[model samples]
Target: MSRAQIEPGGCLILAGTPIGDFRDASPALRETLAEADIIAAEDTRVLRTLLQRLGVTTSARSVSYFEGNEASRTTGLMEEMLAGARVVVVTDAGMPSVSDPGYRLVAAAIEGGIRVTSVPGPSAVLTALTISGLPVNRFCFEGFLPRKAGERRRRLGALTAETRTMVFFEAPHRLADFLTDAAEIFGVDRRCAVCREITKPNEEVVRGGLGDLVSWATDHARGEITVVVQGAPARVVDIDGALARVRELVADGVRFSAAVAQVATATGMRRKDLYEQALAKREEHEDG
Candidate 1:
């Protein structure tokens, strides 16, 4: 197949390759890969295999662009884009810079006034949410949890009151621990789904509360995992209780602002409201 011509100037094309299945790649991707003057692939071997699978031929120059060398290579890639090179960047799977490399290059290209376009493809975020059996009205993508148990718990603590669905990417090895911590922080009863090897032949979605899913992930699980966690239940307004707690914490030598933050975290109240109450309590303390 003949490759479509890319216009002259700094054009940075972020092409999305399939997450698992080869057939999932789009037509535009093949043409872009063929036409790009420089192909900055996450894995050159994978790119070669992908090309073979798609029966696409490319005489374009290939270079490795991943986490280790992303910073250094970004500068050179942007320079090429500025020189009117059609530069194409592809990750081993899915869109680049979505919890992956290519962010630095994209930022540099945009900063240099280059044209950055994308051939949109599959994403695990949307795919997991679609089958999560949780509320998707409002959601946030938290790429990965901290590896250590303590740090992971702290991260989950910080997100305790988040009322939107949360998504995370986890390696198969640590998935059990991640799910266990999630159960502790988000509550054992909180609904969640573990999506594994999405778009692959053995793609599976394990749906259950956090505790149940943790057990399921313990055995016979080896693939990419995307965990979707349901958010905490919304708290009812308790202005009087919140104000009282803030006042007590302040009297106990906790700084007024710090007290307010603590109260907000405990009560799931907006920090702004708690701050106003803390200010009033401080004024009362001074006057009294």
Candidate 2:
């Protein structure tokens, strides 16, 4: 939480553009864009279109500051700020700094003693998370997993035990693959939601188990996609009870490893603990 300076040479404004429907644009966002001395846009053309749609005309200087030249352009923006120029940064859509460009410029502005503030508006992440109907008390934003299958699965595997609702940004083309991998690693029954096209007329939020979402995404749903996945359920802490459950399952003909795994998933117990305890219990019974 960086605070803005009451009196500074200049200010850097991070403007949040509408994710989909231009109508979602806020009055403050339009005002900030209109009053800017210099506007650094991720895509100048997109900014131009947005200005026309919002019906807000500005004489401010518009410069491209997308990912390609983010590093190279930050220096120039910083110079303008130090020279008592008010610069506003706008991404193609949504907030400037979240999973988008502006972080470098914001950090530089703060470091250079320039004021930093935000014109918050529509956010795909927040919108999706809200409609997800999942637990919002605790959540994490994991924007974009690895594009490659192996790497994506590895990433999902690490998050298998995450207890917070997880939000992710993914390309439409990779939605199915991501859901499939998420299902495999997080389990087929794990709850999740896929939000598409955000605020636009075609906006859709498909909510279900990871397995169901995987099937839905196979249709290659278009437009920007945000995924909200329910975290792993709370784990049961009774090792002895968990081992007893495992033993019962095994005695009923479930394989030892499978029984342990099943009990671990059901009770949030560790498979290793259940396995070792079950074995020790068996050995102790034999000794008696």
Prediction-by-prediction clash tally: 0, 0
Score each candidate by Cα lDDT.
0.86, 0.86
Q: Name model 2 segments beyond 4 Å from true.
A: 1-8, 237-288
| Candidate 1, lDDT over the whole model | 0.86
For residues 155-240, could you state the per-residue lDDT of candidate 2 as single tens digits? Answer: 78667667999999999888888888888878989999889998889989888999987767888579999999999877647887
Point to the candidate with the largest TM-score: 1
Tens digit of per-residue lDDT, candidate 1, span 140-257: 9999878888988777877877889999999999998988888987899999989999999999998989998887889946888898999888878698888998889777997878
lDDT of 2: 0.86
How close is every model to the real structure, measured as TM-score? Answer: 0.86, 0.81
Top-scoring candidate (lDDT): 1
